[model samples]
Target: MRRMLKQSALVRDNNFKGGLKEYAKEMGKIGKFATQLKIAGYVSIATDIVGSSIKVYEAAPEDKARTTVVETAKVGAGIGFGIYASYLIVGLATGGTGLIVIGIVAAGAAIAAKGTSEIAGYGAGYIYDKVESINE
Candidate 1:
């Protein structure tokens, strides 16, 4: 009986150790995935910032009509890029399940970029017209 009890205890010990090893492996995988997600988030945000800056820059008034048209196209491209980046970020962050969240965030970013660009463009144009008028 004593020998049998010892053998059972040993088996239990081994099983426990195996379970712990498996759990550790799973945790390590989770950690790696989380780290990747974090890195992706940072990259997305950086890209968005750059896109927004480009839009803002394009908003500034240009003296030539051709330049203005080119700037408008650039601003549109910037907004489009920002929307795509935001969608990618949200999809990655939520594992592609949160459709509402992705749509809202993407839309919000695009709208914000458009509104900001328009405001800045109008302001710059107003200032330029005022300056030109004053000079004349």
Candidate 2:
């Protein structure tokens, strides 16, 4: 059955609400790593953004998925920044030795979250592609 096959993708975890929650958290984790690497001058922010943009447009809706991606990215970014803002602020306030590092970490994490969302969208596009391809 088509519905049964679709359910297969979920494996041990299958629920729309559960999926979204996992997606957002995964994005956040990816973002955190991205920030740390970017701060070390080991990565390009532009590259990540470009990749995400492409994904957004791939399976895009009538209004363009980029819009949705951006909106969702913003929400994700906001959550990331919120989680770290206080630490960054206090570090700066105390004249910490590495506020720059803190900032980079925060920024990277925010962007990473966006990129993760992009990746998720890309997966969705993959499924669409498969359906469009068909064996017949």
Candidate 3:
């Protein structure tokens, strides 16, 4: 009977140890799954942020220039007129109508170039502000 009892206790101890090992293994798998799920969640959020930024950029006025002829013409005319007028005054003081015309044309071209650059800068700033606001 003593030998039988000792054998029973040994069997119980072995079973308990085996169960603990299995539990630990299962917990490890759960931990790995949890970690993967967290990584996936982070990736999803990052994708969403990028998608939203793209949407905002696409919706902006600068991006719309490709499709909006009237707005483009208006901006072109305004910049040309404003910059040409400034340069024309200087050209008139130094030369005649010929120089004034040349100055106007040159100023219009320069303004067109600068206007494009400013629009790009403004678009970038708008996107930055939008993203910052979204994060907040």
Instruction: State every prediction's TM-score relative to the real structure.
Output: 0.36, 0.29, 0.32
The ten-residue window of minimal lDDT in model 1 covers 8-17
Give the candidates in order of lDDT, highest first: 1, 2, 3
Q: Rate the local accuracy (lDDT) of all candidates.
A: 0.54, 0.50, 0.48
- Model 2: residue 42 alpha-carbon error in angstroms: 28
TM-score comparison, 1 vs 3, better candidate: 1
**Pairs in steric clash, model 3:** none
Superposed model 3: Cα runs more than 4 Å off: 1-18, 60-136
Name the top TM-score candidate: 1
Better of 2 and 3 by lDDT: 2
Please identify model 2 stretches exceeding 4 Å from their true place.
1-97, 132-136
Tens-place lDDT digits, model 2, residues 1-136: 5456345443224322345455446445545654654454324445555655665577448646445555446444444554465455445423322335656655666566556655655665565556656944
* Local lDDT at 93 for model 1: 39
The digit string of per-residue lDDT tens for model 1 on 1-136 reads: 5456344433235423444444345445545655764565567556755765565566636546433543455455555655566556555434422334544555566567656656655665666677678988
RMSD of 3: 31.6
